[model samples]
Target: MTTTAPVTTPKEKTGAETALADSWRVVVLNDPVNLMSYVVLVFRKVFGFDEATARRHMLEVHERGRSVVWRGVREQAEAYAYTLHEWHLTAILERNETD
Candidate 1:
């Protein structure tokens, strides 16, 4: 009779799994420089948000001082933040911090 230890293999994450694991948020901060209409326009242009949706997010930023405009993988979040910066809007990336 012989005894042997069982081997265990580590699971590898697929692309979708990795993306879900690395979720991020694109938050826009309220600023004194840009007008509300302009912010709405940028949101529409950058994200293809409809007028009502754009205004909703714009209002959130205006009233709350910040709004999370988008949530997705890190790369897309970074791209959105960069584009918002180019449009002169204050934007940042934050980890999702939830499952």
Candidate 2:
């Protein structure tokens, strides 16, 4: 048996588009409210990043002002940012500058 993918025409975008092709970053900002370990856990639990990477990103947010937790399509980036917000974490979406 063989499977075939469906065909569709590319639609033109109306509003402003990002620099990169289907890529955005979910950034987490550093705050005085959350604990270091808690931030790591949030990265792991929310973004599914492993402990080491999570800790690394968490540290970046700690020492620096923010860190890009994830990079993907805008929809996913917004979703992740919203989830982090729900978890009481500061997060935002940034369009990928490099395509």
Candidate 3:
């Protein structure tokens, strides 16, 4: 009698699945050009962060030299970084390894 091996199929990922699989972060670096209040305003405008939240992130950047302003898929993270750069804040994207 002949035996046949079981067939296997690769699963496809949807947009959300792919996004969740590959996480990214948008980080803002401290710069002398932008005031803390300006950074907070940008955060509020770009990210819709509340005043307290914006201030918290601004303070983090001030004391730590860098703050992770957002975390999500690469596309969104890149967009956020670009917006921050346009606002004259130093920003960068990094892969989120924790997820």
Candidate 4:
């Protein structure tokens, strides 16, 4: 007599689970409280961005009201956004539209 492997079926993902699988963006929104210099400093400290790159993102937030600082998987984006918030920056997570 011989044994055979059992069959298995893949489960379909629900809407919320599908949404979580999509990419996410970490955005830093401009706020009245944080100064331009301080924003740049925080960007550098939190993200390890160099002076020029940090300044670029800071200016984007200052002039454009917000900047997409990082884009990646949802979990990491959430962590980055949370870290920025912990640093007192106005950071938020947004679903990446292109995903």
lDDT of 3 at 85: 86
Q: Indicate whether candidate 2 or candidate 3 has the larger TM-score.
A: 3
Runs in model 3 lying further than 4 Å from the true structure: 1-20
lDDT, candidate 2, 12-44, per-residue tens: 774445336678988899899999999999888
Ranking by TM-score: 1, 3, 2, 4
Backbone clash total, candidate 3: 0
lDDT of 3 at 39: 91
Query: Evaluated with TM-score, which candidate comes out highest?
Result: 1
Residue pairs whose backbone atoms clash in candidate 1: none
Superposed on all Cα atoms, the candidates' RMSDs to the truth, in angstroms, are: 2.4, 10.9, 2.6, 7.3
TM-score of 2: 0.77
Quality of model 2 by C-alpha lDDT? 0.87
Best by lDDT: 1
TM-score of 1: 0.81
- Tens digits of per-residue lDDT, candidate 4, 47-96, equal 89999999999999999999999987888888898888888998988888
Instruction: Select the stronger candidate by lDDT from 1 and 4.
Output: 1
Q: Provide the overall lDDT of each model, using Cα atoms, as 2-decimal numbers.
A: 0.94, 0.87, 0.90, 0.89
Full ranking by lDDT: 1, 3, 4, 2
lDDT minimum window of 10 residues, candidate 4:
14-23
Per-residue alpha-carbon lDDT of model 1 for 1-99, expressed as tens digits? 999999999999998778778999999999999999999999999999999999999999999999999999899899999999999999999998764
